[model samples]
Target: MTGDERTTTVGQLPTPDRDRARLPATLTRVVWLLWALSLVVLGLRWWRGEGWELAGVVAVDGLTVVLWAAVTFFGGIVHSYARRYMAGSETIDRFFGRVFAFTLVVLVLVAAESLVLFWLAWLAMGLLMADLIGHVEGWPQARAAGALARRHFLASSALLGVALATLWWETGATTVSGVAATVDGASPLVVLVAAGALVVAAMVQSALLPFHTWLLSSMTAPTPASALMHAGFVNAGGILLVRFAPVVTVEPAVMLAVVLVGAASALGGKLLKTVQTDIKGTLGCSTVGQMGFMLMQAGLGFFAAAITHLILHGFYKAYQFLSSGSRVEHTAPNGTSDGGTTGPVGGAVVVLTAIAGGALFAALTGKGTALDTGLLLAGLVVLTVMHAAREVVRQSDVPAAVRYGAVPLVALPAIAVYATVYGAIEGLLVGLPAVDEHAALTPVHALVGVAFLLTYLAVDTGVYRRSRRLYVALLNAGQPARETLLTDTEDYNEY
Candidate 1:
């Protein structure tokens, strides 16, 4: 902030004038107080162990309680952190206000039972996020980023409207539950359109492929705003899917399409992350990948698993974004030459541990016990465990015996924790129709599964680095708008 604070300048560009900057302590306290109140509501809801409806426009259920708790928890953390982080900046009060408003709108969004409130809340959330993105008043790049984001958000909001309206017209039901209940007998064309619209809306909200540039260019937002967006805001997509699971699950083709979209983004996000040159960009791309997996879980007919991923991802990304500035020391790689690369024996051990991890997950959660989409989920667990176990064995500065033994010791506990959380969330979402809805795995799924595996292997092997075309495509795909980057320095001596 230079010159008059009311018209703070960035490189000689003065934005519209604003009121004097004020401390954000009061707003931060208010958000925390709201979080506390939400927790109290959650406790009462928990004790009651059932949901209620109000005039068919607002519904409070297990999903609502848990989601509200998660939203407010993340909101409280971001607000507290921002109180000190943005204390001295000009326009800090508005930043806090937008953030608070965004949080409240999200609370409204999840509990909304009718199409009108749902759509309105969705649009309001996006507009608030756009304001937060453009909080740096005088930076042209920041303003451009915010506008770009607003366009994408508006598109998402529009699609959501189309989805809800089509469902309403087809089923003659204005409320979410009513739509779900009557959707079975609706025309297939209407179902297809509504489901497609819903999935695309989720993709846009979560920053999936072809709709991710906004997030990539959103570095203009303050780190705290980034944290809030990455942590709680992006999860809107998954929440939308879980809320409308019945609609999307109506057609096998739609579910397959959802799986395909998610796999593409999951793999593409990893590719994009590899090409990133900065910490925030890397984290943003990582969120994209994580969201893809969450959507994939939902498409696989395990809405509980998606919610679990969404909640865990919120906690992780919030911490990653808030603490991104404090990075680890740069040092040479660890471990001996033999341990660095996997030998046959080490590979065998890792693979075995991963399979065992999957089996344990199945036993604990009753998922993947049959030949359905759940089996694919179990495969994902195996893949995840295999990746982690391999890394653990490869990085340990110990003898082969201990390293191999450590795979099961560490991987099994992690799998147990994940299963425990999944079970708990499934319990919380007991009344939801799609909590553990399992469908038969079809040929389309098989094709996608194979492609997903191949993409993973290719990325894991540095194939992108070797193939110039592939690398260039991914690089170009992930780049933000040219205007978002500073190209020249201004010389102030003339002034």
Candidate 2:
């Protein structure tokens, strides 16, 4: 069979011959049209140099337009892909409806001028997602996943409501922009409490640590839903932080808490990803790790970098999920490998090259305050170390010298793209409220950096690989429901 035929046949359930596949195609076209219209509207608004503002209750700026554009762009792509991938499914129309609705809700949330609208949109999105997750009503796993997601989302919404209420009570600002503008004048105690609540809300929404099971369980949903959820909704937490950057950046305690939680989630998610046996599970774990990284960027006061990362990762993950069915066709038919390994010396060379490339890019950007600079430098070191390790694993057969040379060639271009995107976002958000003061890096930041480096080294060096028990535990840490979800029972019993 041809590659396309093979992909279409794999893991696909048999559908009735009379299935109305054209419904999904039509839905896809509608979604694309809506996306195009949004672009036109946003562009005209930008051209006129006027944003919609409703008595400090609602506002839209360049940043809002940019974020809305991204959501629509990705949402359209996913809709188009799903039109084919889910063509024969019985509930294709329902799937398309939910996806389109969720996309619209996200657009509203991103452009919401007031805190009340943003919170309502946030809650609505979560409920819509849960409905989508339970689209296959007869499937027990889908029901369980939906239930888990609803519970977490409810808690997240409550926390976010409290945070918003506090901001309003203290600043008498009903709009996000208004709240941000008045944050500096609020009492320190009020700011800290509100920021803490917001961070916790973000953590829950992003599925950090204890709240991550929903993401994994959610793989039981249709592929299109999974793609959209991970690619878009999962990053809402980062968006939340960026939206409230003025407050989050000023509260050092809140920032420290964010960094700590983000670091833990990143490490745990990465470790879990290594042990996943299924593609969806692996992708789910990866989303958690990426969310953690995004939150860490926000914690370090790299608001622009966090936004850039969110946008890029959304596109990358959407592609990953939509094309996941082609994995079988792309794999080596014989399943054999050269089994080459990069020794310590080669690994060191790759790491050094990556670090140098990252440092050079950081210097070129020349943005951020001194504290931001230090935090960026520290983050770059960790990023490069991880990047080099990945490169080493992928190209284990290459000579050390050639690999070392290639590392810069690859790393530098990626860094450049990141910096360019970050700069653009910074420019767009320049008029928005942001913390401008630079504070010296505290010992906690230093310790977090050290811990990340050491953990990476240990994982790369096979410390966990050497311990079978540890490896197994890490692999199954948050996967207790995996067996229940994957089992092939025909009964409609709820899990």
Candidate 3:
């Protein structure tokens, strides 16, 4: 067939038709307004130190306000985008309904003061998202992905329920705030077991490490659904940690475990991210890595930093997924340089810039509220420096002076934004319950920080560029399970 004929045939396949998307589009706008008003009311109540209580079981606080605002805002944006993105899809209305219902559940989960309500909302949110994942009903891939998600979510819900039940039994408190208040006096063994269960639940919900396949498989779903999954629901783990910070922080062993797990998952996800060929796969892995970092921050007793990271990452991921349809042309092919550096000099520049920027940040932020926070700040500095360096390197033909000058111009705003957001979170969450007191820098924390920084720098500098086998393995890691399932299904169908 001629190119024109093929193009016409392809164009006739289901394409977005905005005219038919009116219901979802209108609902999106109305929901956005309602949530905005809810956020304002919640914020005012928090300001007045009279947080609104519902049914004597739910209460809204700063954390609730911030998280609910994120869900509503991003939820609206995703819906609006989906109105066009999923316009011609047969199940577009179902998609919108599921997303709206999921958002509502998440808002309730975050704002729920009662432990029972929180757990129920959490489960409902998961099921709703799973429905969203399988919205393209006839697609086997969607079904498989949704099934995987449901399995993991069900496990998470079970574990969370056990943890909450344990907490209630031990503390005689059924409210989140009440349980947190009673954590200090609870039996050590009970707290430890409950904390461990909660950690596992968070790990599953956040798609950390071995439990991450659901997220990868979920790319088969529509882009809007993928966006919501990554940007909104994936944050549950971080929120869980933040909510129970006081209790978890007190358990040194649990905190240590959290740190180790988070570090492992962060590194694993990042490495796997480097190898993905597809855009959605890469973004999914990126979310996994970002979740690891956020959890790591929480583990390190930087609850405020964790919250900031969660909120910002949510916004960033939503934007990425929404704009991904337009980014196909910009995606770099595998094994190609997208202006990143591999040379020794480039590596040196990256290290030096990281140190200088980290020092400046530490100075401005007063050593960052905790040792881990300082390390996180340093790591972010490295990332910012590397980004700026890549920009300069990519513009190699530009005047040397211009390139050097652009570094500061680029780095300054990033630093400023980081400092501003970190400061704001610290201020906003000051009165939040369950926050552990920030510990001073310790020898162990320092070592972990240094080790993480070195490892990250090595990876960033392309030390693995020559390891083609490893690269290929990492790139294809996400496909095996789905491929196997699909193959088996096809074989069965043929028989």
Candidate 4:
């Protein structure tokens, strides 16, 4: 069947054979249902303070159960969404099968106690996602995207393999739990090298900074595939780090380096997002920034917070990708936004609300403005609340009093909900050690913070718009590979 002969005329995605769709849809739905039921069972066990292990093969505890619940829940949501979204696609079953396989692999990854099993599951996930990335097999752009992603994923796998192999060699531990127990006995040099490999592997998988092109170029994936990849797959990095927190935190310098790398990626991702012209590209950049921030939290000795960050991020990104189509209709004419002005009264309200939000966060989460990473976390909470307050005040049409009142009403509740979730996640992740570490504030942190703030201010104030060289550089960096570009419809039609 040719592209022009298909029934789906709604978007750029290919159409399916209607008759064949039901089989895959039904099979996927069945699996999703079973997966969801398993989550319930796991939750019950967790509530009862029970855990399980399979004699050094697999384990189900706080970390495993939480990740299982998260991945399967997202998988179920994607499967349900795709049943309708992919109804008329020819390879609907194939897509569903691959997605089903990927979800299972992730479940295994989270549960695997054996290092070899965990590594294999991790490797298989990338291969499955690469296949999904090129689900539109006839499209050369899609094929190129899949190939690029495959290469990056392969490299990520190789790094992870090397890290795990080194740990096994040094610690003589065949299982991840065993490695953690004996990792300290390994030489410092060996541990440092292995930890570095793990960080690189995670960065590649999460599409952080220099490794981000693969994800950005993967726009050719079906929307459902994109949603699953962004929601669940990219989150593996944070999970990897969290699971191996013992190795990562062996040296304070290594953790500091993670913070530096994460901060750089976070800043870079946000900057690059501003120059993206496409919706998927922009969202890809946003994922990079979010993943970077998650890693930063991990580096700060907040593994539980990192897990919470990824779980919430998965929910948010999945919705964004699935509903990206609606964004077109709602887009303002000529790309204009509601950017009126703010008055002095509204400005004062912003400052007050931000402070209150910060206080509320500290009180609720037990992370106050101390001489540690808690200060950084508190500052982020303040900025988030301030941004929320700013948006409310930006509504020029609303009365000053209403806008002022609405700021706290919106921001406080959000802060409260987030703090509550953070606490719950911390409790659920108690089985894993090193979930929360407070790094003492250093001069380097202060310097980096100042630089990040200045860069943010410059970008927000449109200072970069005047710099042609910087803008062009960023634009080029933000673009997908040349082979992945679909300049004309004929490119796909040629197949």
TM-score of 4: 0.93
- In model 4, the Cα lDDT at residue 50 comes to 65
Q: List the residue pairs that clash in candidate 3.
A: 246-434, 275-475
Model 1 has a clash total of 0
Give per-residue lDDT, candidate 3, residue 14: 74
**Which 10 successive residues of model 3 have the least lDDT summed?**
1-10
List the RMSD of every prediction in angstroms.
4.6, 5.2, 4.6, 3.0
Model 4 worst lDDT run, 10 consecutive residues:
1-10
Model 3 lDDT at residue 136: 71
For model 1, residues 232-308, the per-residue Cα lDDT tens digits are 88899999999998899999888888888888888889888988877998998998898999998888888999999
lDDT of each: 0.85, 0.77, 0.76, 0.85
C-alpha TM-score for every candidate: 0.90, 0.87, 0.88, 0.93
Clashing pairs in 1: none
Most accurate candidate by TM-score: 4
Candidates 1 and 3 compared: the better one by TM-score is 1
- 64-136 per-residue lDDT for model 2 (tens digits): 7778888888888988877777766777778888888898899889888878889999999999998887778
Model 3, range 255-363, lDDT digits (tens) per residue? 7778778877887888888777668878989998889888877887778888888888988999999888777886445985555333565456555665667766676
TM-score of 1: 0.90
What global local distance difference test value does model 1 have? 0.85
